[model samples]
Each structure stands twice: as C-alpha cells, then as structure tokens.
Target: MDHEMTPRPDRLALREWHVDDAAAALSVYSHPEVVRWLIPDMDRVPGVAAMRLLLQQWIAESTRITANGGRWAVYRVADGRVVGGAVLLPLPPGDEDWEIGWQLHPGVWGQGHEEDCAFTLASLAFERGHSEVFAVVRPGNTSSAAVRRNGMHWVGETSKYFGIDLQVFRLRKADFDRTAPEGHQPPTYADI
Candidate 1:
C-alpha cells in the first residue's frame, strides 16, 4: 500500500490521494449520480474544504494500515485527469477477505475507466501475495458490469459486509493471470 503505484502507461494510474487533489475529487464525489450509488458509508462531499479534510484523514489512516491495503486516487495517464478513486482493503467485521473497489466520475462513465481501475487495484493486491479479492456492490448498481469485465465472478448477495445487502464478486490470482497476462493491457473501446 505504501509502495509507489504506477499502472501501465496505456492504462490508468493509481497514486495516493493528495490534499491538492480535493477539487478534482469533488468533481467525482460530489456528483449526485455518483453519490446515489455510494449510499451509507459515503455521502456527497459538500465542498473543496470538506474534501480536503477527508483526504487528510485518508492520508493519515493509510499509515496505520500495515496490510497491503490503502485507498488511491485514479488518474488517466494520457491526459493526467482525475477520474475517481480505487481501494484495496480488508472486508470489515472479519477483516479476512480482501476487497477491491473503484469510483469514476459520471463524465467518464462507460469509457472502460471503471474496469481499468478495478483491475489495477486487484492486480496490486495479488502481487502483494493476496490469494483473492472481493467486490461488493449495491444490488442495483451498474458498476457490476465493470467488475465482471475485470474477471470477478459473481458470488451472490450478502449483508455480511458493511451490514447492508449487496451483491458480491470475487477474483482469484490465477483467474487474473489468465485474463490479463504480463504486459497485456485492458481493451480500449475500439478493441472491444
């Protein structure tokens, strides 16, 4: 988690969120569409000042997480635009299962940034010696498509995580190796 994160040049880049990124992050987290999907654990970030405080907390918390887990800001490598964020962390309560999650601004939705972000974080978990990673989504959330495309298999609904009903998807390290080989990048829109 503390190591420098650099995804493929052709794909998205993952880095620790900085306080200066608050404005760009606001563009993603404050959107009504994005917030509706987030629901309970997160709400629409009201302003740049509030978002900066939140980022500060995240930065401080990352230091206490000794596991290979942390939150990252997702960026488009081509233009260096902040699309959203990605996270690799332990599922709460049990803290045994690894979870991978991502969020992208509505402005960049359906352009494959979701899949790239999800895959990038999950791959990082695997490389850090985790055997598998999970993704839990709100029942009706459309992000499931990106999760599936990233090679995560549906594992059915469960309220075990976050004490809320949600659909869960999982991916193993072996499954990832088959889906995206070394040096292989996720498909672009044209490639799809």
Candidate 2:
C-alpha cells in the first residue's frame, strides 16, 4: 500500500491536492472553456485566491471521503506541473454507484491526459472492488470522446446524479480489465 500511494515518476501522477496548487488548479478551473464543460453547479474558479480557498475546502473535505475514493490533483511527470484534477467518488442521493471524472488545462487538452486520468482512476476503482464506474458529461460537451477512448460505453442520459441532464457512460470491471495493460496499477490513496 505504501508503494502504491507513493507518487510515480511516470507520464502522469495523481496525489492529494496541496494548497500551493491553487495557481495550477486555476489554470484548469478558471478557463472559460473548461468551466463551460463542467457540471452546472460548479462555477469558474474566478481567481488564484478563490482557487486557493477551493483547494482548502477540497483538502478538508477529502478526509471524509470514502476509503475507495478521493479528490486528486493531476500532475505531469515530466515537468511536475499540475495539469488538472481527478476524482472517483460515489454518486449522490444513494451513494451506491461510483463516478469517475477529470478536468484538464486547455493547453493539455487532447494530449491523453484525460484518458490517463480516467483509466487510472477507473483501474483504482475496479481494484478497490467496484464492479463498474461511470462518467457523466454534459450534453454537447466534446470531452465525451476521451471517455470513449478509455473504453466506456454510452449508457444513455439521466438527471439523477447531479440534478441536471447528462450523458452517462459506463465501464464495467471486466471491460476495463480487457483493455488495461498487464500488471498495470494506478497510484493509490493510502496516505489520504
């Protein structure tokens, strides 16, 4: 578990958010293009101060996150730059189904960051014993292609999770296993 939690010096890494990441996080959250595709409830991060405050809140709330889930800051291994955020958590209302999501800086868009985040988190979820994981994208959002690239199947739309219509895609453990590289294991959240 200790080894699993340690940040990998690979193409990308996932670890818990840090206060100093506000500026990098802002790069992802404050952009109009990124914000426009996010869930309706989330607004543009506004500024670095606001991004810092949000990171603080997310860090505090992270402690209460379930053992199999967490909120993480995505980093580019080559430059150690914060490129985005990733999360794998149970959906709201019933909290029975898990959801996998990521937000990347516009500069890194279409560079496999989204797919890496999705596959890593989905692998972690499956390794943690979940049978399936879902991704919900707002209609007309072009990011759905990344989800499909990760092998998730379109499962139709439903407003149940976020109180707004979204295109739901699902990836079963068996399906994910078929595409996952042999012996591939994502960084874990043991420290969190």
Candidate 3:
C-alpha cells in the first residue's frame, strides 16, 4: 500500500484512515450489530482509548506494503461518509497469505458495500503485484459470506490465521479478470 492512497471503482473510494475517523469508527465498531458476526469476539468493542490506539496502529499499517497489508477507510462517493473499512493485510509469517476483511456500519448493511469494498481492495492487491486475496469468515457469518458469493471460492476451514478458526475464501487475479467485464481494473492510489 502507498503511504498516500485512494483506491476504488467509480462509486467507492478507499482513503487512508485518519484520527477524525475515530468517532465514526466507534459509532460503527462499538455497536453490537456491526461486530457481532464479523469479529472473533462479537461482544468485543474497542473502548475510546483502545479505539484511538487502534487508529494509531492503522496509521502505521497504512504506510507499509506487506503481506499483512493495510486498512483503508471506505467512503461513499455520493456523500463522502465513512461507511466502513476494508483491509488487505498479511497472514502469519512465511505463509505469504494476504487477507481481505471489512467492517461496515449496520445502518448501511445489505446494500452491496462489503462486496464492492472487498472486490476493489482485492483488485488493488492484484494490481500491486500480490498473488491472491483471501478472506477469513467465521462459520455463522452469512453477512460476510456475501464476499464469497461475489466471486471468492471457499478454500476450507482453518485456524492458521490470527489463531482464529475461520472459513477461508480466496480470489485470484486470473479468476477476477476472467469474471470481470472486459478492460476492468481496480483503481490505484493515484487515481483519486
């Protein structure tokens, strides 16, 4: 990931996360409805201090280009609201696994945002010289299953990543390109 980035399709943009996003992050992430099915601990909500510390971590991650990848804040083109966040980060060392994940506000749930954000970020990864994009979904999270439905194939169940057992899904650039309309490509950080 570039230190400065804004990557997306026409309707969505993935911007670098900023301190200003703290309230928005808390608003969405701390709410039970958003994290319940997505995170390992559905009951886990980062407190204000914890969230701020996390924001700092996100800032650091955004600057690095690694298998662990980085997180980008998702913005709606029509209104510029920070609706959610997406990440294309690395798995554990030597596995060379790149993971894609999303955390969206429940207010905007079921509107295809996760699919759009994940697809764009995965495309960004491919465009950036990465081999494959993966997503780890907890077994019962049919909400997160939408990304798998978008085009990712189920690899299997595993606890190898983050030490959390999850249903793994994957999408390769070859497959992404084949499924995309002709001439389709994910936008670059410079595109914004």
lDDT of 3 by residue, 58-166 (tens): 8886776554367878767767777778777777756488887888888878765666676677777787788788888888887886676558898999888767888
Taking the candidates one at a time, how many backbone clashes does each contain? 0, 0, 4
Window of ten residues with lowest summed lDDT in model 3: 1-10
Alpha carbon lDDT at 152, candidate 3: 87
lDDT (10s digit) by residue, model 2, range 74-103: 887677788888888888869898999888
RMSD of each: 5.4, 3.0, 3.7
> Per-residue lDDT for 1-192 in model 1, tens only?
122223455456777788999999999999988878772478899999999998999788776775588878887777777878877878887789988888788887876667666766776787677999999899888656888887889999999988899899999988886655345554322110
Arrange candidates by lDDT, highest first: which order? 2, 1, 3
Candidate 1 local lDDT, residue 150: 72
In terms of lDDT, model 1 sits at 0.77
Higher-ranked by TM-score: 1 or 2? 2
Clashes of 1: 0
Q: Which stretches of candidate 2 lie over 4 Å from their true place?
A: 1-10, 181-192
Each candidate structure's TM-score, on Cα atoms with residue i matched to residue i, is 0.87, 0.88, 0.82
Cα displacement (Å) at residue 153, model 2 = 1.2
TM-score: which is higher, 1 or 3?
A: 1
